[model samples]
Target: MDEARWIQQARAGDVESFGRLVRAYQTAVYNLAYRMLGDRMEAEDAAQETFLRAFRHLDRYDPERPFRTWLLSIAAHHCIDRLRRQRPDLPLDPGYLGDEDPDPEAALIRKETRETVQRLLRHLPPTDRAVVVLYYWYGESLRGIAEALGLTVSAVKSRLHRARWRLAQGLEATDEV
Candidate 1:
């Protein structure tokens, strides 16, 4: 079935349809959450919460909009809310406590890059960071972001552009220093 058809079925209280929808988008949603939250456990929790919230609000979803966008918005809001409530002093490795990567060098590089971006993201306000993550990291479009955040499309575009420029400048400054 098409996404809209599944959405419609899910909205009408079809459990199987909803499960199918969840199966289809679970990885993307989890990956997005994991990147934003920087903790595997929190990401999993957030991803679960996103689908739950989306399922609860399924009736309110406008079928004209993409289903994934709607679901992602829920996950983003949940992750941001959690981040706001947490203490910054605590360590950020939220996944398996002692998990080792198979490729140590490549893993180290990825971990370092993630740490750098997370550090930079911490400097941004939640809304700006969400825009940056959704647009640049997750490849969400202006319209998708706007729908997700309940912002105007123009506002989403402007915020995304500004966030990208700021991140670029930050990287350049780091390179210089």
Candidate 2:
């Protein structure tokens, strides 16, 4: 069944339908959590918590909005909260730890790239990090990101611009080092 059908069934307390929804979105939710939290165990915990919250609030979900967007918003918000609470130290490698490449060199390059990006991301505030993750990693539009993060579109735009500039300056500095 499609997302809508599954959602309707889930709202009706169909365990199987909700299981389908979980199956469909687990990887995406996990990836978002991982990106924001930068720790494998923490991300997994956050993702599980996200799904639990989503299920509890499923009745409040608006069908007019995309289901994945709603779910992602939940994951993003949860990860942001976690980030604020822990405020972990930087240089967290934010790669999809589950991924594997056939070539060792390619894998090494990807690992380095992820480490660089995560280092850049660590400098941003939680809200700015959320904006970057939602926009760049998830392909969310400005409006969509704003809605997901409860910010105005202009605010989202400003954050994105500032965050990108910070990343650029940071990368430039690293290049000189």
RMSD of each: 3.1, 1.7
Output the worst ten-in-a-row residue range by lDDT, candidate 2: 89-98
Worst 10 residues of 1 by lDDT: 90-99
Which one is best on lDDT? 2
Quantify all predictions' global Cα lDDT against the true fold. 0.80, 0.89
Best-fitting candidate, scored by TM-score: 2
- Return the lDDT, model 2, position 176: 90
Over 1-177, each residue of candidate 2 has an lDDT whose tens digit, in order, gives: 398999999998898999999999999999888878787888899999999999889999999999999999999899888888894764465565658989999999988888887777777888999999999888999999999999999999999999999889989987898
Q: How many residue pairs clash in each candidate?
A: 0, 0
What global local distance difference test value does model 2 have? 0.89
Clashes of 1: 0
Candidate 1 global TM-score: 0.79
